[model samples]
Target chain A: MPHDHHDHLSPSGHPYRPDQDGPLTYWQAMEIAIRELMVEKGIVTAAQVREQIDAMDARSPAQGAAFVARFWTDPAFRDLALRDGSNACAEMGFEVGPMRLIALENTSRLHNVVVCTLCSCYPRNLLGLPPDWYKSRAYRSRTVREPRKVLAEFGTILPEGVELRVHDSTADMRYIVVPRRPDGTDGWQPDRLAKLVTRDSMIGVAEALPATEAPA
Target chain B: MADFAPGARVRVKAMMPPGHVRTPGYLRGRVGEVERVLGPFPNPEQLAYRRKGDPLDLYRVRFPLGDLWDRDDADTLEAEIYAHWLEPA
Candidate 1:
């Protein structure tokens, strides 16, 4: 499924700043004003802001999928990821910042899903900023109350005997779901397998696609 | 420092102290097992407001999914909770 990448801008791309009386919300205007003031005051340079944005923009689900694929193929790495997710990512050349990263593995009997009930805290260093649905209040409130229904909406149907575990990220920590590898792709290499991993699957909403269904 | 280990029974305190708190309302008074010690970190409740304080032990508490909801869906609900909000059940 195509992900939503909505942005507030006209097709022509003529700049629309809050100061120019465009459609910017009050809070958005205030944020821009404060940011400009901070830049003016030398508290934070505009270059620093751009650098941070660039770093986040450079990240994608591909990085996270690579780790999950590695875990699926390498039992020793899976142990390391489950034991210290942040270190494991670092060992793989991914920096997860100061926040702790926890990798939850999905097995035949148990499945794990992640949500930030209080706020939209996520593992941005690995998966980039969370999708819009993940930050929705409905998702935040419903996932804990009725996780099965939520997963069903995402087109994920668990086996009758399997259990669903919802992980609410409350503090500085972030979680990534290590989805169970699909059958029939037993001898596939990690690169080929990574293509089957989706952002939703890593969030525990859907399962990885089978070899036949995976994209070329 | 964390006082509890995995498999330890812990209950979230039901009280709602006034101020910024990271504890979710639904989990309060709920019983769960310590899934793991998530290590110590700066108290976010204080850090959110720029108040200085010592780091506190954080833990991942796992509760049976069936116990938290009335639905028949079987699963576990695990959340990361600061050690201060938990007590031996």
Candidate 2:
């Protein structure tokens, strides 16, 4: 998608600085010229970049939802998923690169929220790209200092006595919150149960919807 | 660093090395219990710079929210930090 940089970039080709009085700055023009030269020389192809982007765009929270649904219905699968999330995700045919994937279980006594204080590192294969808010300065700073308040902002009001556990995704380790299965989901199949799990729920900002609210 | 198991008291070293570090600045110098050892992994700090290096042990440490900040109402904070940045509490 050849997006219009008009809104984000100044005429000078800088993001905000418009000191130059040209449509494209010298560096910007040089970049385009070099890119065209490379493509003309068959050094790199534009198709390759688009293909990578399309692959990324194809991933969504549905993958994580499927894993959670399986975990909810099968105790053995739950053990496997909890023990090694990377392996579980791999079994489902998702490529989670090399990082230790840990599934944090949210029970009646605890709630888990994942964040990367330094950068927005996430399980992109399972959960798609990190949301804008997840990468914001406000979230990165406030989550550790005041988790309850942050959760409240996300409309996730925890019950009294439940300790909110914030997991800082600071290293080569990723986290996914396997929220406590909602009540009244008895005998629910994985497909039916998957509908109740949302992206935010897997991130620990919300809970799985009640079965009644689930889609038919 | 290898034998640091769950329930072990560990403190995040206050030292701040230059260049890319995955450990958050806030948790530095804080004491916490090792919730779980997350297994040995390549040193991300080195890997990030494209340097091949040996793996380092990583652990999931849990710190009390009250201890990290003045807010008594905050809940616990857990983070996965590399073993090199930790010490016996």
Candidate 3:
């Protein structure tokens, strides 16, 4: 039997679920009502809503990886990112909406991790939608209180000398952890270096992939 | 005008208002230093009620993990807190 990819997988390669086919949730019902009202009232069109969804769906971790790669290779950009994350991302052609972004740099002595203790506020415009675990109650509650334990759950272990800094996105500001560039990629270009910058690394769950492990 | 400047010691006010408050429960009454003054932004509490929230000064406060928890490590935690939820410590 031939396996039809379209029937089982979404465009992003994740398994597709028949959400609309299932019993409509309360939130989904409310969303439908609001969208219909807005469209009927000429506030917005269905086309515009679809376009917005398409725009958001287009964003992914690849964008953040590119920014990290640039930050690693360019000294001036790195300084700018540390000073003003929004502007630095804009300089790289990624518009991060209205929310203020703060770039946390990981050094030999310090490691930075970001979590939204109050809610699942993330740098969505830069890194796309957060993973399901990021929005879980356990992650939101424990990451601030027992971050070392949470990092260990993600298979990340730091040395005794390295200090960990957890940035809780409690309010309006969003955060991005600039994981330290791996060794042995001294003269690698940003495009190549981006392959080593994984999504988990940017979230501070894990370090950047080693230079030797970068995709060929 | 900002009430607290960067590096100023401040404490998260231990308030439990039953609305859209941004201050986390664990941080209430906890003391920390203002890492930076992030300028005024619309207060989320008021905005949640569909009111035009008057802008409030927001600050990044850094607390030592030991102070936050019973941990022996030297890790630290930073959170963005609105000025209204903070008091001079």
Against the true structure, whose TM-score is highest?
3
Worst 10 residues of 1 chain B by lDDT: B65-74
* Clashing pairs counted in every model: 1, 0, 0
Q: Pick out the ten consecutive residues of candidate 1 chain A with the lowest summed lDDT.
A: A1-10
TM-score of chain A of each: 0.83, 0.82, 0.86
Per-residue lDDT of candidate 1, residues A1-216 (tens digit): 122343444455533444555688899989999999999999999999999889877788988999999999999999999989998999899876879899999999988899999989888877877998999999999999988889989988877788888999988688899998999898999999999999888898988888889898
- What DockQ results do all the predictions give, each relative to the true complex? 0.80, 0.80, 0.88
Provide fnat values for all models in the order shown: 0.90, 0.95, 0.97
- State every prediction's TM-score relative to the real structure: 0.87, 0.86, 0.90
Query: Of the candidates numbered 2 and 3, which has the greater TM-score value?
Result: 3
| lDDT for each residue of candidate 2 in A1-216, tens digit (9 for 90 to 100) | 233647776555657745667599789999889978988999889897678789888889998999899989988888988888888888878777767689988999999998888888888878998898899999988888888889999999998899899999888788888988999999989999999999999999999998899987
lDDT of 3 by residue, B29-86 (tens): 9999999999689999999999999999999999999998866768999999999999
Return the lDDT, model 3, position A134: 91
Task: List runs of model 2 lying over 4 Å from the truth.
Answer: A1-44, B71-74
- Score each candidate by Cα lDDT: 0.87, 0.87, 0.91
Restricted to chain B, the TM-score per model reads 0.89, 0.92, 0.95
